[model samples]
Target: AQSVTQPDIHITVSEGASLELRCNYSYGATPYLFWYVQSPGQGLQLLLKYFSGDTLVQGIKGFEAEFKRSQSSFNLRKPSVHWSDAAEYFCAVKLVRGSTLGRLYFGRGTQLTVWP
Candidate 1:
């Protein structure tokens, strides 16, 4: 079964600090990776994704992610943290092929707190 794992359940960072949210997936083959942010009482917003092409993909809001096949990891990073960036981050995977093609699997989610 394919699944995504976010090691940190909650993270607290001071404003202007660097941020890194870890994401790891378990699948037989490489799967499409996605990072989504959900604000309080809001729907999920796409932050970034990694399907193919470059190993490092830039996303909205100064966010970026690197896909490492050898590590089975697609970790999200930002040089600086903002209070507005505080939200629940979820790591997801989508199957491009096989019987469950296009099926999306999500991680438990990581809650972020930014202190000013």
Candidate 2:
């Protein structure tokens, strides 16, 4: 079965600092990877995804991730952070199947607290 694990349950950062969040997955073959961020009481916004091709993929909100097949990792990184970036982040994997768009299995989530 496919699954994801996010080691950090919560993280805190100061405004204007850099940030990185870890994500690891277990799958038989190459899996679709994604990172999403959710503000308080809001739906998740896609940060980035790794479907195929290049190991490094970029996404909205100045976020990027590198897919490491060897490590079974896809970690999200931001060069610098903003106060508004404070939110809950989730790492997800889309199940690989023949027909349907498979369901996404998400990590428990990491709560990010930004200090002024």
TM-score of each: 0.94, 0.93
Q: After superposition, how far is residue 29 of candidate 2 from its true place, in Å?
A: 1.2
Q: Which runs in model 2 stand beyond 4 Å of their true positions?
A: 97-99
Q: Model 1 clash pairs?
A: none
Q: lDDT values of the candidates?
A: 0.94, 0.91
Scored by lDDT, model 2 comes in at 0.91
Tell me the lDDT of candidate 1.
Answer: 0.94
As a whole number from 0 to 100, the lDDT of residue 81 in candidate 2 is 90
